[model samples]
Target: MLLFLMSLNFMVLDNIIMLEYNLLTINSDMIVMTILLDWMSLLFMSFVLFISSMVIFYSEEYMYGDLNINRFVMLVVMFVLSMMLLIISPNLVSILLGWDGLGLVSYCLVIYYQNVKSYNAGMLTALSNRVGDVALLMSIAWMLNYGSWNYIFYLDFMKNDISMMVTSYLVVLAAMTKSAQIPFSSWLPAAMAAPTPVSSLVHSSTLVTAGVYLLIRFNFAFSNNLMMLLLFISSMTMFMSGLGANFEFDLKKIIALSTLSQLGLMMSILALGDYKLAFFHLLIHALFKALLFMCAGNIIHNMGNCQDIRFMGSLVNQMPLTCTYMNICNLSLCGLPFFSGFYSKDLIVEFLSMEYLNMYIYIMFYVSIGLTVCYSFRLVYYTMSGNFNYISLNSLNEENEIMLKGMGGLIFMVIFSGSSLMWIMFPSFYFICLPLYLKLMTLFLIMLGMFIGYEFSKFSLSYSSKSLMTMNLSFFLSSMWNMPFISTFGINYNPLKLGNFYYKNIDQGWSEYMGSQNIYMNLVNSSKFLQILFSNNLKIYLLLMVLWFMFIMFTLF
Candidate 1:
């Protein structure tokens, strides 16, 4: 809380406080650790600290009687510390400490449930981010050419040098995998298998946003061509997640998909040369998404660990406060007018429209926005409306004040954070002048998506299900473009097959044919031949001894 408040102070002052420590000097090269205390780092640090604190507080009710509560809290603390390290450091070498810490801590958090699902999700999360870690390590190596590792001073100047910009490409790759963009997006939804608080924090900012934040910090290094490439990938990621969420039924996974979509938005905007707007969206997104996850955790708890939306219905009757919280967060997620999400999201869309982009990019941007609204409303219909669908014996009420209080702590922020952040982050307004239709297009899409979602949710009217018609297409969308299959089977299948072949053909088959077994047979055959020679020699010596004895006896006579 103190750190969060301090961020406001830092933002108002408009000053960057950089602290440098020369850790070592070898020959002419020096190893200096740098801490940058600009508004961006401070603000981001404060947001992380705030969200982590709330998550810890919320876990008191969520993790109530767990045996390893202390261990869980410690891991969360470690995660927060790593995020702080990541936010403050300007040097790539020092930043690795935080970068790797997030990966390790998140894996621990993801596997906390002690189930096969949790373990699988944890491995996917860890291994997917490993790609980014390797990319960052490579980027650090490239940055060594800049003499000093503090890239803050050099990224802008080095953008022109093609040789030096290899660091830029590596940085982009790291950001892509870290943010779970396109090819790497499968892990984001899989991470939903983690505990809700972990999902809330990780999805909000700690793990996934690490890439976007890093890119925001390194935005100056991206050339136009690089930015164009990033924009395309980010746009696709946004579209893919939105499509996936609509097809998704699992409550937490849908929210997780929403997180992925928003991340794509942040990255796309960052690529479009508005790092500050991206930061604004990032901060506001952290607030509402965290709250959304908490609400999800509460609902899942009440439903007796049931996370499928189809099993939830008329929740508003029993848990009005939670339902309300969930709806507000969902609305915020949809960028509803006057909501916290709208402040940042609206500005981003307007700014994007102002840019000179091609047809494909433009179409993706609006279509993704519509899909986001469609999914949110679809989720609303499934979980909140219709008849009571949950078990009648179960107790589903909002008696858990600890959870509510933790959630309440962020309600004010989720509602008003947009305008407040806009004032602080962007004191100057962007001049967005478009004809009335372009401005109204966002509203039109929202209405259209809401209608479509309502129609789509009414699946009972037609027993002949539409998904049954094109099962392949639905599967493709729901699986995040078959990325999970590719990440798991496509990647592991060949290596595993080759390993099996080697074990059968070489270790078992060839060893018996020409290795140890063959060597033993050869040894036995050689010994038998030598034995035959010795036996023959023995017989010959015996005969010679008899002949000599006979000759001696005759001579003596």
Candidate 2:
């Protein structure tokens, strides 16, 4: 909170402080530990600390009676420390230390449960993030050509360099993997295998957004071509996650998918060359999304660890406080006019309206926005309305005051952070003039999406239902367009197949026959022959020698 106050003061005073500790100097290069204290870093740091603190408080009630509570708390603290390192560092080297720390610690959290599903999910999360780690390392290597590892100092001047351009591409690739964009997106939903508190902290603000923050930091170096490519991928990610969420049944997975969708929105805005808007959305998103997860956690806790929304109904009657928090977050996530999400989301859409983007991007942007609303309303219809469909023996109520209070800290921010952030982040309003139809397009899409949600919420697996007719398509969307399969078995198939072939033809087959095994057999045969000659054939050898001498004399003649 003090850091947040300091950020406000820094913004008001327009101040930046840099402190460098010179660690080692080799010729013209110096290895320095750099700390940049500006509104951006301070504000981001403050938000991390705030969300992490809230998540910890929420975990108290959520993880109650767990045997490994101390270990869990320690892991969460280390996770926050890693994010703090990521937030404040401008150097690629130090950022990577934090980046890897997040991957490692998240792997620990993801497999927190002693179950096969958790183990699989942890492996998926770790390996997916490994791609980004390698990319960042390659970028660090690329930056070495500039005589320094401090990328912040060289970003502007090094833009024209070929090596730096390659670095930019690597950096973007790294961001994509970390942000779970398109091909790397399977991990985000899978990571819901972790406890909900981990999801609140990791998905909402820290682990996933690290990519966005890194890209925002490097936004100055991107070419137009790269920006267009990034826009396409991010837009697709937004569309994919939103569509997937509608078909999803798991409460945590649905929320996780929504986080994926919002991340795509942020990445797209950043791709549009508006980092502040992305950052603005990032801060507001952290508040509400964190609270959203907390509400989901409370519900899951009361439901005896059940996460399927299909089994959840009329939750408003039993868990009124939890339902209230969840509904507010749902509305905010949909970007309703007065909510915090609306401030950032509305400005982004309106701003995009003014840009000269192609038809594909424009359609993608609007449709994705609709899909986001579509799924949110569907989730609301299933979980908040209708009759209770869960187990008859279940006890559902919001008696956990710790969880409620934790969520309460963020609930106000969820409602007001957008407006407050807009006031501070954008001292002057943007002058965006567009056609009335264009201005109304976004509102129209939101309404249409809500209607679709209502309709879809009525769908079922009954014999008469038409949804079964399109079962394949529904399965595709619900399964993330088969992304998990593709990322898992599909990705591993050819490599594993090749390995099998090598094992048959080389490692176990020809190599065994002609290499060590073959040589051993040959040596054994020769030894047997020598042994026979020396031990048993001595008398026969004398007779053979006399016969050989006679034969040799005849041949000589």
Candidate 3:
């Protein structure tokens, strides 16, 4: 721990010294920064460090009996380093390089459990991530071919032509996939195969936030069709994930789905061009989510990896410290007043009011928040308030001292930093902070969710499992309206089938067209030069061609 602090101090000192010497200057196409120091980046970096340390500390105790402690420690440090680099990156390419490193490390860590389930989950995440990575690469290639590779490239692409439109759509698709937005949201819930500490780091604090960060950073490109796409995608993702979380039985998967839901909310806020709200929510979500995942970890570790909350009950008595921390974190998740979530949640709604079309979005956002409260409270109550029916595998059952201390310290940090940092970031938030009526409204919604969750606890399932519920009713309802204005309304709903329908019914003049093309095909096929060019000696042909050009040049001289 001392060595870790010293390393942090050295990085800070290096950055300070570089700034003092004016060693890092802003390019003409770059945003000015004092050695790339900015309030937002600094704040995000602080969260990364805090959470990474807590997770490391937690793992020291959580994995004490496992043989792979060294491996875990190495991956944890690499994770921290990669996130720090990503947070401070000054250019898009540099940011992407950092992001790739982060994805690689996170994928490796998610499967650290080395079980079949974890292995499959890790592969699924990597596969989805590869799709996003390819999209990003294509976008980068397009941007470099047209606009400059500097920061101005994003600024210049807003009014560019058709290519820019295609590139922008591709980027939005990639961002949604990376952030685990709807349709691509299944990977995250399955990612619960990871241990709780890794889940906390990836889902809550670092990698999942990358998509929102990219969207907010590239708001200059939000002008064209991209804005509408983001709004729809974000709305659908939030609405669906909220319902998904409601039905999930695993304690970890519930939080995982909630992460996707909250990320969707942040994306929607960004779609409205409210950068502050998006970033503010990112910070608050990171805190509460990290705390909650750690608490879940504590519960699971104590129960010898019994993941279903259906079997966990009356934990408040057996694990008072974990319960207290869980309650506070749950309150934050529930968005109770004076907690961290309250400030950010309210601010986002206020920002929504400023947009014309955003009122409906605000309604949906609040509904999702209510759902968030419901799932969060359900998670806490089900795992802590029921009868203690669970049996510990080890007779001398207790949380590791190191793990408890780590978790307790993280909970304290969340409480302290959550409120104070909000004030520091946006002092204006202090005055317009939810009015008495709005506070009551928000509180009422939260209480309604708690009531539902409380009622839900009375009815128990005979058998419950952690994998995500096979189907989501809310998702079906929300997506039923997405047929593109000509399918169910006037055209075909199945795009692929439409292609086959066209081939079967249209273009009956195929033979005449083929006959006309035969002469051209024969002329090309009869060319000896072309035949030679297609031979394996194609490289030699190219060499002879170059020599002929040289001979022609000599004769002219």
Candidate 4:
């Protein structure tokens, strides 16, 4: 039904439906709820719902036998609803509601397992997202300068206003947090602590993409400096994630990092002033990434919960269908020709090459593209080839019909979604007239990455004692440049130290001496002194009373 509606909406791209109502009125100002539905919203909503439906179906088996399966499914549904709200909302207030919903629901989903790791990961996810929530709120407050919270009405007029540039900065900050760009990226891999289905939904389609979607919508408002800043950060994020994925040992984290890298690609393109291309890649990425996670989930389920790629090998002989699907997703991730990913990714690189960019950014773009292929090939080599490294007696059969059934639904889309969306969304193909060197840069990097990835993964570096020399560098790359530690402990360490200092010096020392305790003690000593004076000396007390009476009589006179 959603696909049908989306197709129909596509046919009438000129028709836009707007719905607005006053939720609150204060004097002359009002808080209004606004929804804008054009082809973009309808198309994105259709894709989100379709992917969500498949993920929910996949969860039915993947989450089977878990104690809170129903709760899990409900949370996933709520996530989709929040994403829909985000998609349709043109009002800042309405977007906040959806944004907060995504953060809250995702935190709940991340901590669903109720374990220590889940607890930590959930905290990281929630707090990191809270930064974006705050940024969105700030943007909304700033938008009040335009007399309306609905930014869509004013984006064009306000684009050149210096006062309105702050709102753009805040919006970009919010997008960066949701998308997990650079310093805020640790939570994404941590979020893999959640169940696989949740990972598929959150990482692939909904939560992470919310930021990119925002940038796409607000692309008109960005200043040149802002775009350059975003371009640099996004390029760094892409390079960092791609490098980290090559060193990661856990299967899901590698995939999670890959998602992070692709997100950077999307943001970089958006910053390059091509919102349509960015949106195009965002949709294509969602399809194949969701399928990739499902395939990983299937492999994990069959392997008795082992996620280490080192423990997995020769799946071709064991689970042929699952292996085939896994290979398709992996190859598509590497942007193999004619696959869903190639259509969007290839176009993005070509467009970027044609742009008037510096050599630094130009090299970064192609090198990041190459890094993507590198890590992907490394992942494939580690998991899909070589001898079976698991225990020999393990039954690694792919007999779960429900799981396969869920993945089967996406297989066709994984192959064709790119081509279909391209024709539907773009009126005409982008004509790139770049030099041969620039045009073939992506292909050359891909081949180079493949060779480097094969050599890196195939050779064991630990055999030589000299390997210790690069241990620090190796650890840096493997630990994602220690971003998790920096974001978590590094952020908390200073505050905690200062808090302890204040606790001891202020709360226990000066505050105790000079606050209520000292005041009470002084009062007690004064009262005792007065009581002794009255009780121990009756003559003195009588004299004091006489004096007091005389003073009162003098005042009256």
Candidate 5:
């Protein structure tokens, strides 16, 4: 553990020392500082090392019996290195390189279990991350045409308009895809098939954050006109993921969605130009999220791989230490008072209440925060309390004492850290403190969620066909909340049958527009053009011959 910490520090120093030449610098005309290592990036970097180190120590015990422990450790190290490289890279090109490497490392780590489901999840993550990379690459390619690509490198990117309208839109798409926003979020839920430590790293401090980090890296390009777009998209992501988390049954999926929603909150803060608040929240999230994920891993390890919370209950009595740590972490995630998440989460809300932004955005932020509390508590209750039907009491074995000790240490540190220990250690990092009453209010929300969650657990869940039918009926009824007419008149009705009845005489009508994603796929796979251009080696040879002939003719002429 000491060696690991030392190595982590060494890695940070190596990066700073090696990349010193290309360190951040300001652009000549831009108002933003060109190259600056403000508190935000530094703070995020600190969290990365902190959470990653925790993962390594926890895994020492968690993966003790596994055969591929060395590979796991190596990949974990590589993953950290890749993320650091991405975070500290000087130019857009280096950023892309590191980003791609991080993506690949994460995919490899996800499938480390070597099962069909794990492989499938890894593939999904890869495909989605590829979409993000393609957007980033396209932006880089655009910069190539304008001669400004090299001029705005590293932290210096803050000083130039490297992103034009098209590039900005593309980068935003990349951010959405990378952050698992909206429709692109399907990949993250599936990503639950990975080991829990990987989930912690992916969710808390690493893979999922690359896109938002990039956005922050180029804040100058976005600070003026795109604030509204960023805010709307981010808040909507928070709202959607929070609601979706409420509906999730898988423990890791719930946490994964929570990760996305929290990141959306950070993005929202960034959009509002509250970089300090966003940075603090990002740091605080790393602490609580890592704690949460590690606890989940312990649960999975102890319960012999159970995932669905519907089957779990009475675990608090069985694994008291695990339960205690998990509960505290859950409280933090719910933004309870004196927990790290409280101050950070409230700070974001405070920024949103600044009156210049749309009132609804502020409302949505609070609603999402409340829903965040709801789902986070739901995660704890469904997994930790109730009937012990799902968990095999006979089969359950408490995790190693060392693992439990690590979790305990984290909880204690976060509690003290949240209070004032961390502030004493780094006074410069503290931006603005929350009011005591506001902190109490944050705890009130958490306590409210705890009560609601407790009430929910008292009712025995019935999986009988009748109960399932009721659930289906309820879901069908509630689906109308978002777009009532679409749910009632369009989706519930068989569009295929309706179109068949009407367009039976008319060729494909709605399907044409409906399959635009497929159309994009088709355009991407246009083999006919490839065939005409290079299907045969003869075509390539002939083209080469013509080019040579033209060259000779031009020389002679």
Candidate 6:
């Protein structure tokens, strides 16, 4: 209720509120904590808080009977707080506090289940995010040259400066990692090891979008060259995740990859200089994505922990509400007309089509959009239409009032957020008049994707000889192009091997023999000699003193 009111207030007032405090001053430079609240932050914050509230409410039933429920809730609360800090802060240093907090809390959440898979996933998530953390720290150091950590103020000024351009590049690098673009994307799907609520919150609103929000805030610093590079990478990320989602069978993982793909869309649109549209899509995506995860959680809870799509079927008859909500979210995700996604997605496509971009980018943009619809419909058919494939003893029912209530809040937003935000965010919508063929390009691709998805979902590839013929390709797509393995084992393999080498040759062998072991052996021998000499009594001591005196006299002579 508070978030709804806040959203309304921000929409009506459209005000900017700046809050700042100087933490320290050094050599006439101020290290300050700053919060810049405008329509963007207020609208995003309202969405974040609302989605978080729903996720927490849903977790009440979804995570019921767990011994660590309280801890889980606290971690989630902390995650929300960190995200809030990230959203409000305009200062780089202050943003780091939130950024690092998010990485840490998300790591904790990912590993909350005390299993090997969760542990590995948590490590991958943390280490992958640490790349961005380092990049952000570097950006902060670079921004120090400007005398203030507030990159928001310096974005336009720094555009022409070479050194600041480097900082901008660093900022983009950081955003890429946090947003899970390209090499950094492996952690996103792996992070589905976390509970569903965490998936909904982190994947949808807070964690993944942090990068997009950062890029949106720093859009002023982006050069033409930089934007092009960003566009290429973001397009690949979108296409890659979309393809990966199509191959995925895990319920939560499919959604996670979809989040990744949407994040790429957000970044790509931002690169296209439509930060407002990117922001619009981010918020709308959050609404449906969160609700989508909740629906998945409800289904997972009812299906005895099975997440394979093959195990789910005819859920529309068995669990009408869950299916209804899931279908709405999925359709919205597909950018169906009149849904929240269509408002922002349609605008982005139209604007892109009208832009003078190269064929590569144009193709990627349309193809990825089609891929989006493809995986979504494929998911819908497999989960909602087929015959039930679960074991005989499984109980599939939607009797959880708390879960339904949690979803009830988001269903309204999922249906209306895009339209409402369109009016509020862009009061004067400019018409982009395009040729009929160009205008209908998005619709054509969407329909084509649906057709392909329907055909693909109708048969199991495993039953065909072509499955063996394309086993390598299937494995690549299903494994997200071996990204999980690369991020998990590939990242650690060399480091672990180096550490082992050092332990064997340096710490245990060379360093031990030359330093600690040698010193210990020398000390032991000396102690033994001293004890033997001391045991020889006063006569020996007197003789030694006389001999020492004679030797000193001889040396002096």
Q: Give the winner by TM-score.
A: 1
Candidate 5: stretches off by over 4 Å:
1-40, 145-163, 223-225, 391-393, 419-448, 460-557
Evaluate residue 450 in candidate 3 and report its C-alpha lDDT on the 0 to 100 scale. Answer: 84
The superposed Cα distance between candidate 2 and the true structure at residue 538, in angstroms, equals: 14
Candidate lDDT (C-alpha), each: 0.89, 0.91, 0.73, 0.89, 0.71, 0.90
Better of 5 and 6 by TM-score: 6
Candidate 3 lDDT, 1-557, residue by residue in tens: 34334434544454322131233546654432322455566667777788888888888888877888898889878987877766666455666677788778878987988888888778777777777888877877776655444443455545466656666676677788789875676677767887788898888778889878777666666664678778888988887777667766788888887888889889988888777778888988898788888888888887878888888888887788888888888887777887777777766765564456745676787788788887777777787786776655543245478878888777766677567656556645433545666646766788888888777667654434322352344334323223212222342357658777666555334654466556667777788667776784879878999999999999999
lDDT of 1 by residue, 1-557 (tens): 66666777877777788998888999987777889998788888878888888999999999998999999999999999998899999988778899999999999998998899989989999999999899889988877676777888888877798645888898889889888998999888888877888899999979989999999989998898999999999999999999999989899999999999999999999989999999899999999999999998999998889999999888889999998998999889888899989888888888888998888988898899899999999988998899888777998889999999999998998898888878877777789999999998888888888888888888743445656658778778898988999999998999999999988998889776799889999999999998887889988788889999999999999
The number of residue pairs in model 5 that clash at the backbone is 7
In candidate 4, what are the lDDT values of residues 1-557, reduced to their tens digit? 67547656755567777898778999987767888988888888888888889989888888889888888889999999999999999988889999999999999999998999999999999999999999999998888788778788788778988657999999999999999998899999999999999899887889999999999999999999999999999999999999999989999999999999999999999999999999989988898899899999999999999999999988888888988998898878888789888889889988877788898888887788788888888887888899889988798888889889889999998998889878877877788998888777777787898998887899767646546658878889988899999999998999999999998999898898999779999999999998988787988888889999999999999
Per-model TM-score on C-alpha atoms: 0.93, 0.92, 0.75, 0.91, 0.73, 0.90
| Candidate 1 Cα deviation (angstroms), residue 257 | 0.6
Task: List the lowest-lDDT window of 10 residues for candidate 2.
Answer: 460-469
Off by over 4 Å in 3: 1-35, 152-167, 358-360, 392-399, 429-439, 461-557
- By descending lDDT, how would the candidates be arranged? 2, 6, 4, 1, 3, 5
Mind sharing the TM-score for model 5?
0.73
Candidate 6, 136-214: lDDT as tens digits: 9998888878877878888897698986898889989999989999988888888999999899899889999998999
TM-score of predicted model 6? 0.90
List, residue by residue over 295-366, the lDDT tens digit for candidate 5: 888988877787778878778887888888888877777777667776677656655554476668966887
lDDT of 3 at 365: 73
Give the number of colliding residue pairs in candidate 3: 2
Give lDDT: candidate 2, residue 288: 91
